[model samples]
Target: MRARLRAPRGLVPSLPAFAWLCAFFLVPAGMVAVFSLGESAYFGTSPVDLSAPSLDRYGEAASETFRIVFVNTLQIAVVGTVLCVLLAVPMAYLITTRLTGFWKYAAIAAVVIPYWMPFLLRTYSWRILLGDHGPLAEGLGVTGGFGIVDTLSGAQLGVVYNYLPLAVLPIAVALDRLDPALRQAGRDLGASSWRVFWQVTLPAARPGIVGAALLVFIPLMGDYVTPAVLGGVQASVVGSLVSSSFLESQDWALGAAAAVLLILLVLAVLAAAALALALGRLVLRAVRPLDLAARLRPRTGTARPARVSGDAWGLLLRGYGVLMVLFLWAPILTILVYSFNDGRTLPVWGGASTRWYAAIPDNAVLMQSIGVSLRVAALSTLVAIVVGTLAGTALARAGRPIRWSLLGLLLVVFVTPEIVTSIGLLLMYVAAGPALSDGTLRLVIAHAVISTAIVAFVVQARLSSLDPRLSDAAADLGATPAGAFRRVILPLAAPAVLAAAVLASTASLDDVVASSMLGNVGTTTLPVYIYSTLRNGMRGDAAAASVLMMLGTALAVVVLAWVMQRRGQGKSFAAGLVGR
Candidate 1:
């Protein structure tokens, strides 16, 4: 007798996503790896040589000039990551613990909603704010002596500003899951409030803190945009070096080698972190007996409260939070105000007028770029939602090994630097001949590669929080697998999926490096347009373009919120979004 069996649902649905990734993401990456081995083509016009490859490019990449660039990049990324962690941890703790009700929700929304604005616009806004004639420089009477723009300090400021959300969200999630009873227990046992925090709280949040650090550190190491826009040539990092190698020098091999080296450096950092954790676990095991004894004898029956009163601390923290909010928005506010300035110069705000905004409609190039950006964003978001949701579902339901493999691939995409991927995608497009020279399809493919990972991560987070028993119950009732998914699981996952789609769209819209490298004439997106305007000394026009870009992406975020609210998951989704 033949046995009756039902095929698995998730893996089957997951095939399309897997294939898409292999074709678009993995192929481009593999091509780059292959390119790293070959000799440089003359002006990058001749066909690539596929002969026996050597480590010639690697040796060149390790030259003294490049070594200094690597060290500088490391120092900046480390400093920026440390600053972000210090700022984010305390702020996230305060929001989770001290704030309540409406204030708590409002606080998170304030931090999150600003991020919906394209990062390119935010960086551009910073450029104007920190320029020699800009507010900060003039106000401090250091217009020429010392300022952020075109300097390493300025680049670090941009890094911290851009990646702050990444550091905060993970730590916030960890804090949300933290049990208040643990802290209370420490206090009742005669430990000071600081001691309770040091012993009971920070350790519990270590994983999230580490994750946040990785998130900030990885991107900072490979960042080209912040340095390009704010730091200028003097503050060039490894990312700028890679771009110069490929585009300016037209040395494909050297650029590929530099990209590979950057990836290795990131991997090294991850390995060091893993080793440190292992060593920490061993040390903890060795000191376990001493720790237990110390705990047993520590009771003084004289528990001291925190140094500052709770109300005073809350007030201070709340004030600091407001200041941070202002700091984050200051550049954006500057851009918005200056967009309507009735003058040619950017830094000197002329009398308020809407001439710049009016000029936008008349600029054919600007309008065309806007149209291209919208279509690309829309198409990329659609692809990301479908592929990412399927991949996320498969990972959630698949066997342990399969799940882990999928997770590794997703993380690889997440942590890989944008410049590296941008160059890689550029090379792949170049290799595809005249048929693939058009930028639109290549741009969408490049964006979908990264955006899909983001969507999958969001969906996976939602799925992890759900109970498998709900699906099992449906199966127990004789409902078909597809029927159960459509009737039960889909409703639950819809809010997160929609939110992910919005995020994906925003990411696609905000992209700079990938689109810039892959794009040719007549294919410019808004970010590419803004970059060109800046390069060509059209700051006023860039500001106007930026405002429009911000409005579009911000609208998507508003829609995301509405979707969550309509699905009756508003509060829960907000918590998840804030990394609770």
Candidate 2:
């Protein structure tokens, strides 16, 4: 049967995506890993490093600041993961297993829509909505009291709000796949709902939760916006530390070391999570007893389901969900509203005018930054989508060796922190010895490595549902292997490939950490420029910048969503796009 099975076509369905990943992921990651071991000079600005094997930077990471930031990064990651999981699980449960009918799809769509928005917009919106004197405080009538506008709480909110959907969707999918009958069986055997949940639900959902935690934790550890805006100086996470080191303080060695430590920390956490889960499962299996066909079956009685009456608790959940949604959106709203401001209070609607927006075309650096960012994002996205798609398709069609090599390459980027990734890219660029000194090319290469990893996973998921039969049927009708692929596979997978391309583009567009470190002076991205504008006190120009970036991202999301909806197979893929 296996031998008789016709071969599938060009893998073109995933070709663009696969090619994007390949160009971006494997090549860039390889470049970065090489650089991490190399040396960086003049704060990350000079050039790359082409040196012999060494651990000097890794050893230098032993400083107190590195230790503090490392610990803090881990703390943020752990706490953020826990918080997102707690909130996401309940929300996902209620939305998925619990609720049905009209609100179900709408609820999922609500979460979906915001995720598609630009992430920087999402971060900035929180700052606006959560500001101490803003409507969030006033609405709750906090009463001349405080708010989390600039506190760690605000940072936490930023992390959770941006990532909640990321955490929720994966777990919801896992929980949705659970056998409902498992719960019923436990109930029929006299187990309480809570007991059944603890035994049946949590266990099955564990992998998904672990996946969610890994997804959230890894990114949180490397994130810069949440900390920069919400955290301010009150407990700067590792990402902020790395950015400061390279961009502000010129502490390249320390930054490199810290980046290296972060990579190690990520590995340790992954191992620990895996090991802990394994042990937990083992312990649960050993101790957990079967219902054992309880001695006397209870008289059958219709089970009264736990009801959510949509009262205060329901209202609270709905309100929190809405607030979270607004938190994700309101900054863009504020930015939009304030782009018209004459340069006054941000959260409030000061006088309106288009002066700021009009004046933007005159601000050369800002415009230059915009140009540089778009160029970088565009190239990076192209590279990522192509490389990512390539890896995905190859993995599907490849032999074991090819698959392993491809995955191993993706993992390098997946595990490497942005700080480390940047430092590595710079050092390696220098090490390449002036041949690849063009900053734009370096940025593209750097982005490809990291983004290709994500593209691969997404493309792979899309490929799972693909019907090989389509390709096989084409091939049997005299179509060549390549022709079959071009005719059948490419068209079917076009939606996923396109979606991945947009995703990679947007992520490249918003990134600051790596861009700050590796982007040459003239090539700073939008986030870098906005950070610069913030020093002038988040003014109208800055607001305008925020608005511009927000609109750009929002436009991308809309296009992507439209593309996804047209495909009709985009529900899952759309949900996965909450954050980069």
User: Clashes per prediction?
Assistant: 1, 33
* Winning candidate number (lDDT): 1
lDDT of 1 by residue, 1-580 (tens): 9999755546665677778877777788888888888888674465356586888888999898689788878888989999999998887887787888888877777777677776877787786777766777778886463556787887888888998878877887788788888777776666666666776688777888998998899889888788777777767788888887876888788888889999999889789878999999799777754462355335566664437665787788888888878977887788888888887776676789888887888889889998889888888889898889878877777667667777887888888998888887887777788878877888888888888888887877787778988888999999977788778877888777877877788788888888888888888998888877676444676678778778766775668677778878886566545433
For every candidate, C-alpha RMSD to the true structure in Å: 2.5, 5.0
lDDT value for candidate 2? 0.68
Give the range where candidate 2 is weakest over 10 consecutive residues by summed lDDT. Answer: 290-299
Error of 2 at 189 (Å): 5.3
How much does candidate 1 score in TM-score? Answer: 0.93
TM-score of 2: 0.82
TM-score: which candidate is best?
1
